[model samples]
Target chain A: MSSLGSKWKPVIVMVINDRKLRFGQIAARIHVISRKVLTDQLREMVEDGLLIREEFKELPPRVEYTLTEKGLALLPILNLLEDWERNYETKEVLAEA
Target chain B: MSSLGSKWKPVIVMVINDRKLRFGQIAARIHVISRKVLTDQLREMVEDGLLIREEFKELPPRVEYTLTEKGLALLPILNLLEDWERNYETKEVLAEA
Candidate 1:
């Protein structure tokens, strides 16, 4: 789990799990994340073979991220986790806390 | 995934996912973990409703840990992750680095 241990790594995977996303789009979707941390997470995933960082030449320049096969493969597990969190692990745990 | 974000948390879960385990069993399986960090992670999981810590009034007093329903529900996801890491994410990524 070390590869995916950070708080933001799986969230980043969640955001771009299905489609390509620009940096701003990702940051917008997960608003609580700081830009530096997001950048660092993305870089790590790219290094780890879980994500593909793409760049396009344009007027202002464009960058996007998408999952590699390795990354896409993680979707089902993340989906299960989301389901578990939503249905079984959420409000009750918080209320208890 | 805040409930499961710690590096040792999922490993701890994996260690005892299918059966009850004593502290020494868990620590032995995940050999690199320090005793203090393992205790802290187990305590956090118990607090978060993912594990049950039990004490037995035996000769020396024995403590064991098991997963709650919430934690058991995570088994399939963890299995998939273990599969992914074993087949796809391990050697190739490490060799590339």
Candidate 2:
């Protein structure tokens, strides 16, 4: 539960789904999260066994993140959550009108 | 996301599920949460439209809490999360052995 407790973790997982993404790429995708918070969240996710942080030995040094099997398992559940929020928001809008 | 951000919110939602429960009944069901925290969580759930708080004009003035449509909708999602955790724990145990 702690793994999913962070608001950004699920978003990050969704962003990095099947593709491996660099830190900058991930930060760029999620506009609301700050770099520091993103770093922290990524670290936590790696520690929780949800993500794999791989570093490439290059001139500038590149790092990429990919989801582990555990993290991949959350996709369907998160999709459901997104659907629930969408429906909830639609209902709220209708109620307001 | 804020609605489900609290650690106790999901637990409370699961605790109340389909049946209406009094404050004491809810507290008794979840031993770890303090009365103050439970009260706060329930109030937030009601405010978030996840719960309905009804007061009975009985001799003792009983009050009960029940899940709203939105709350009831979370059951399947929460169940999936529980299943994920169970599998995750099992894997952890296997890895440790």
Candidate 3:
């Protein structure tokens, strides 16, 4: 919980679980976050040793990001948070039920 | 997890569990935090409907803060996070422990 991640960090990690993704692809997954913030957060994650960045010398400058082992290690915690939110935080449950 | 809390939110909430506390008290609990930042974060938590702030118009301008129902409901999530941080994220444990 004291990690260097914003509110969308768990969501981003959850989406990219067990896979690598491009910058734009990651941005597209979390709607409405500015390119700057996502990029900044991703860079921070990299610095924090939670992500691995691979750069390729291609026509459009191919770049891919993937979670390191430590990052993958966080999946269970994210799952716990998601479960807590769905079961408690989200305003979807019926009062009668 | 997606709640409007920073690194110290769970720490703060955990410290004040089931108890109402004053502004200075909270600031004191978390070391090295600027009074301004603590005040700002607490105000944001209140705005997020996770905390209740009571202001006493006394000679010293006393103020007390307590978690609302929504805030207290988040205890379990915070507890899970603390557990995760202890068993996983934090830089503790002996090598090969």
Q: In candidate 1, list every pair of residues with a backbone clash.
A: none
For DockQ, candidate 1 versus 2, the one ahead is 1
**Residue A7 lDDT in model 2?**
72
DockQ of each: 0.75, 0.69, 0.39
Q: Pick the candidate with the highest DockQ.
A: 1
User: Which regions of candidate 1 fall more than 4 Å away from where they truly are?
Assistant: A90-97, B57-59, B90-97
The superposed Cα distance between candidate 1 and the true structure at residue B74, in angstroms, equals: 1.0
Instruction: Give the per-prediction TM-score of chain B.
Output: 0.86, 0.95, 0.84
Q: Give stretches of model 2 more than 4 Å off.
A: B57-61
For model 2, residues A1-89, the per-residue Cα lDDT tens digits are: 65688678878989999899999999999998999999999999999999999999998999999999999999889889989988998
Q: Write the per-residue lDDT of candidate 3 for residues A1-97, one digit (tens) a residue.
A: 5564367677777878889999989988887789988888888888666789999999999889998876787888677656755665445355335
Q: Alpha-carbon error at B14 in model 2, in Å?
A: 0.9
The model with the greater lDDT, 1 or 3, is: 1
Worst 10 residues of 3 chain B by lDDT: B87-96
lDDT (Cα, 0-100) at B94 in candidate 1 = 77
For model 1, what is the alpha-carbon lDDT of residue A5?
A: 77
- On lDDT, the stronger of 1 and 2 is 2
Better of 1 and 2 by TM-score: 2
Better of 1 and 3 by TM-score: 1
At residue A8, what lDDT does model 2 achieve? 81
Better of 2 and 3 by TM-score: 2
